[model samples]
Target: GNNSGNLANISLDDILNERVKELYWEGFRRSDLIRYGKFTGDNYLWPFKGGVLSGQGVAAYRNLFPIPASDIIANSNLVQNPGYN
Candidate 1:
């Protein structure tokens, strides 16, 4: 119960690791990494991130989920998300 450590001493990496440990199964990892600017680019990567065994930075547009093809087809005004179409 003694969570009195100085928050300033906590590194971003520590915070990210803790979030991963605490919220791994809740599906927040992607969003968390994205919020920390680690979801794209070379800042962060794990095994198979982009179907590579060593991991790799993905395109920036990957940060947003792609609009469904069906939805775009149904609505001519709807544009497929960049990098998805």
Candidate 2:
């Protein structure tokens, strides 16, 4: 929208990275990192992402969402997983 065109020297990578930062907190960081091949690697990381300050690949078991006790009590159809409460 701006006619100044002062950033003609900016590289495509820089522009894309800037946009990714702008949309990071809006729930695009995960997909963006996956697309860029940085989600599960040591090169690029964010604080407290995978339960570490420096970021790392999370354990597969950590992906489970534990069912609450109350829900189990009310629903007999619910079967508590072997390793979960």
Candidate 3:
């Protein structure tokens, strides 16, 4: 059964309008706020869960993946990516 007839023909603007209506400004608002530098000033760091902290130490430079640990270990000549110790 071709059910395509049940769907209404829609344009990109129509889809965008529907998304704006459903999401109600929440999606783009965050980026707009951040672009104005609002996000950085606030306490934006996501709280690290207990397991992650225990395994990796308190969330610090070392907490981030260290240039993909396997990559760093395999290639002693390659410098570890910055922000990971």
Task: Give the clash count for each candidate.
Answer: 0, 0, 0
Index of the highest-lDDT prediction: 1
So what's the TM-score on candidate 1? Answer: 0.85
Q: Give each model's whole-structure lDDT.
A: 0.88, 0.67, 0.49
As for candidate 2, its clashing pairs are none
lDDT of 2 by residue, 1-85 (tens): 2488565576645755887878867987556656666666556567876788877765434334578889999999998864685
State the number of backbone clashes in model 3. 0
- Candidate closest to the true structure, highest TM-score: 1
Q: Over all chains combined, what TM-score does candidate 2 have?
A: 0.43
Off by over 4 Å in 1: 1-8
Model 1 error, position 65 (Å) = 1.0
Candidate 1 lDDT by residue in tens digits, 1-85: 2378546466889988998999988999889888989999977889999889999998899899998888888999998888987
Error in Å for residue 64 of model 3: 8.6
Q: What is the lDDT of residue 49 in candidate 3?
A: 29
